[model samples]
Target: MRKLLLRSFYRIYQSVFKMAMPFLPWRRPVLLEGAGSIKKLPGLLEELKIKNVLIVTDSTLMKLGLLDNLIKELGINGCKYAIYDQTVPDPTIENVEEALKLYHKHNCKAIIAFGGGSPMDCAKIVGARVSRPKMPIEKMKGVLKVIFKIPTLIAVPTTAGTGSEVTLAAVISNSVTHEKYPINDFCLIPHYAVHDPELTLKLPSHITSMTGMDAMTHAVEAYIGRSNTKETKKAALEAIALIHQNLLKAYTTPGDIQARAAMLKASYLAGVAFTRAYVGYVHAIAHTIGGFYGIPHGLANAIIMPHVLEYYGSAANGKLAELADHLGIGKGSQSTDQKANAFIQYLKEMNQKMNIQSNIEQIEEKDMPEMISRALAEANPLYPVPRVLFEEELKELYYKIKG
Candidate 1:
């Protein structure tokens, strides 16, 4: 009886501790930036004693001449680097294999990911694959499975969203299965992350809006998530403020560097927050839709965020109210329920402002059941979500997003 009671008490203690851990300890190496900071990449590499580096990115960014600037900067610093510019949005297992080949062939001691989430994710896989050649990337799909320490990595973000820089999670799609698998390991977080706003100046308005919404979703989910701690809450609050203030400005005027910078910083902070606190149903549902329909991840979240928050409101009322006040809505609410509704309205209003549209046709009604199955399977294991979801409820949420 004594032993059984002790075990039960330990379980309870761990459960509560997960809920209450304050300012949850998070660690990432130095972040350096400015318009000219990309020029400093060479010196950072030298300081780390890295000789050869592999640059991981995509063709679009390369076509935009972004990689050329990086190459010039590296040349000025006398750095040796090779380009692996085949990263695609929602990178596939085949993409990882090819990048891994380049990683080994070039004998790269370090890796630089220079696009959005895809490049960063591909870089993470490269690091893992290079560390252990015989270990299949498929086996490293779950959290903390990449046991080997990876090569030194640096990430430079060209988009204001995704926040892949600070995140330990990487999303890779399996072409054969058409499933997006997340590799979650703290070992994958980059050694240095640079958020250069200047790099985002050329981003189109639609992409800016979608990415900024992604950042906002990160803040909202982090704040109300089951994993919310004092530290994560602080990070979430700051991210919310920055994203709220600057996303619209950035969207309306894509060339506004100052606004772009604010969104970039907000996305980075949101990444930092969610990296430790984890995300909730918004991401859970978004990832499913993204994989099944090839919908942009950020846009999917933007459309579905209001519905997900509504479901979460019952269990996460107080936190939602706090977010309302942060967004300057419903200060003198009649009750927590009222405040939560108002908060949801604010989200809807923001979506309208951003011109995000959703239709049921976008997500086939016939496929709702299967999407829920996959989403639940992917989400429940990691997210400290406020409430457990049933198949019917998830289907309802899907319909709501479609509407």
Candidate 2:
């Protein structure tokens, strides 16, 4: 008992010491939330002296009549913009090249990425490429390729997830090789993100469930990440609470504007949390599944979340206990270990309620070795993950989660 108590106190001291160190960096929009923020678009355009803008999105949103609504808003504000709504599930280099072509064709002075991460990522790349036509996308892979000032870029997320609007990192794929590249730069981050929950009310139930779970994963991972700090912990906790309260309401009733708005707020907070603190094995594994199977990014995150949390619980116990208390898990007598497992149990129960599957359809054990390799390849260096795994260990975890 003494040893355990001493270890917990030591861990607490280490966390406090890390918090005192001024290493973790924070970044985001000056202001966030609500419906009428979209009204600020014209002023932003005017500020940038942008007369022409290119909007990048996907066809599903276009067919849903959301595109026409946004067009109406832009017209009311007298913002000149053109639409190139061809962004696909896993946005590719080909998509970036094509969007760049359209940007130059229209003499677009700025870019507005509407929809989820795919469109936002494409727009970031488009913004970068328009400024540097000679620089190959491959050459622009690492940090800070967009050195000089380029076109003004704004992100308007229609979904209550992805949080691509505020993140400095954007992901694009090499289709032929089936590999995803993450581009990190201060310049790629959007100048504005109009997170109107009203926009998300139109999302289907499955989408709402998957995306909400994704936001929840973001908050959880950020709270326990190696790069965590005080501000990030606060953001992650509040975001988790919001998701716990609002996700079910939004999932069952897609037209619930209040629930939709709360979800949007949660996603934005999660973005802020993860932007500085980063993610862990959940994201690392999800990225691999997304690149390989073309699974919706959010669904992949949702499916892998509980499994990864179980693996990391030994390291993340105190944080997980705090998270459980926030979720109202204890009845005043439960130990921290019980609370920690309760949080994992809560997630498992929630996944079942949401109909999230444990098994990836048609992905076999024979493929485990390669999947583990890809997951590790993507996860280790970029992410400030809490726990590190070797190849065999990662492979074992993959099969364990595969069950």
Candidate 3:
């Protein structure tokens, strides 16, 4: 009876979104992709007439000297910039306010995010805060809440996951309360995205595996979710294919330029698709895990992906079968359910090969109720889950992923 009610509710929700969202406007970023694409940044910056850019990154990249060439080019070309390399793993709102102060003090004309998702998410919020000085950044939470367009923003993702470069949303944490809040607006999308594989060559193997699976999760959920368009479907399919072909190679050979490029492309495509289609319960659950436990977002998503699929079961059969067909796994005799299970098995094997754990050691049984409630709050009325998760089911699901 509860499942029936949930299904009925979702049908109405799907109807409203399907009717309205196709007409919604989307932002596209100018993409620079290749081995030496970072060199093009100077010319692009000059073309945009951007001066005194704020570089939002973390200390690790600075320590590795990965930004040396780009920083040198900016200086040699006479573009003034300030570096805020203090962005932590999961960026919080309090520190983003600090970055905003730096942006204002430096009088930065543009914002350049130069690390992984953490820096990019921080930069997006900082841009929003700086753009509308009178409005509280907290008010910009939820969809289309920002009233002002941010300064020209450029993102260079060092990790192949997160797809924070092209996505029209950012996730920022409330550290004190341990709540993860999202800022969703078209204005948050970066004006330009640079996906130079050379920057990704130095990524550790575990990071490559986890982040590659993160991209895979994005593509899979986007393809399966209810918010898909024809364009999103195509991009998602392409992303899935590319990830399948290249993720293992990139994981095994971190220095392989071609494989790295393919993973980057896959991540970009997945981002574009999910930006439109949004993601499902995996992200909703993963976001809560991140907020509560400080688990890396990509790793959480990878760990939760197969379990969500298994839980969704028959309701997810059709789309999962489609993916199986795309992956060349199912023949004529295999049923859709069989194909879906095969896909789930494939994900398990993939995780094992990549050394991704099926469970998180840090998650506690005591926190299960909070996690379940928070996940439900985040997912309902937004995510088009194939199967609507009730509290009873959610508790059981969380138990499987707990240490």
Candidate 4:
């Protein structure tokens, strides 16, 4: 009876939210796509009359000199810039705070999120902190909390996955509490997205595989969830097709610019889809694991996604079957169950081929309770998942994925 009442409440909340979706302030970033597109950003900055900016990125990217070209172009364009390269994977609140300090110290007029999702997430939250100086980051935890407009934010993705360039979410972690959550608002969306495939050419094969699978997870979650709009569904399908065609090619041949470009576009589209439609338990659970154990977000999603889909069982069959057909995976004569299983099998095989672990070895048994609690807290009454699970079912999932 308690479970039934809770589920009914969740559905009712989701229904009301879906009805309001069309009225939400949805916006897309101005895209600078194609090869050498990173070169276009300095001119955009100049046009915007932004003289000082902060570049938020991870130290690895800075050490590799990946920002050399952008830095040079900014200087040539007469723009002053400050670098905050301390962002780590599953960016912490400290990362945002540190970057915010840099933004203030340099009197930055804008923010440039360079590198992958971590940097992007950090940069977005830094913008949020700047906008709401009095409000704590924890106060802006859920949807539409950052009502104030952020600064002139630009996203430059050095990786083909995470799709942070087009997303309105900034996933932040509380290192002390072992909690991870997303702060979502239309204002968090970057003003411009610079997609330059050249930057992704040097990505190692493993990073490519993990991030590609991350994009796939986003597309799949958005398609299977109940809150999708027509536009979101269309973007999800296109993203899925692109990932199916390009992920393996990009993985096997790291320097294939065409494949890299396709994957990058796919990531951007998936970002668009999920940013509006939202993700499900896979993301919820993955975020918890990432926060608790500091696991790579993409790696956790890849391992946990299959398990969550299998748990959804009949509830997800129709959508999974449709995806299977889209991927040309099953015969017309096959049952929906067979087709769905085949699709799941394909994901598992892809993981194996890419050397992605089937299970996360980092999950500890003792952490299961807190992880499950955090995952449930993140999903319920928020994510419009196809099938919702409470404690027992979520516990089973944690144990299944535990190494």
Report model 1's TM-score to 2 decimal places.
0.92
lDDT of 2 by residue, 143-239 (tens): 6676655587888888777777777778887888666667767777787778777778788888888888889888999898777878889989989
Q: Is candidate 2 or candidate 4 better by lDDT?
A: 4
What order do candidates take by lDDT, descending? 4, 3, 1, 2
**Predicted candidate 3 versus true structure: per-residue lDDT over 83-194, tens digit per residue:** 9999997899886888888888998999999988899999999988887777786687777888578999999999998888999888888888788867888889999999
How large is the C-alpha RMSD of every model relative to the true structure? 3.8, 4.9, 1.5, 0.9
List runs of model 1 lying over 4 Å from the truth. Answer: 1-26
lDDT of 4 by residue, 113-134 (tens): 9999999999999999999999
Better model by lDDT: candidate 1 vs candidate 3: 3
**What Cα-based lDDT does every candidate model obtain?**
0.82, 0.78, 0.88, 0.92
In terms of lDDT, the poorest run of 10 residues in model 2 is: 17-26
Q: Lowest lDDT 10-mer window, candidate 3?
A: 17-26
For model 2 the TM-score comes to: 0.89
| Residue range 297-326, candidate 1, lDDT tens digits | 888888888888787657888888888888
In the predicted model 1, the residue pairs found to clash are: 23-231
In candidate 2, the residue pairs with backbone N, CA or C atoms under 3 Å apart (3 or more residues apart, or in different chains) clash, namely none
Q: What is the lDDT of residue 304 in candidate 3?
A: 94
Residue 66, candidate 2: Cα error in Å is 0.8
Candidate 3 stretches greater than 4 Å from native: 1-7
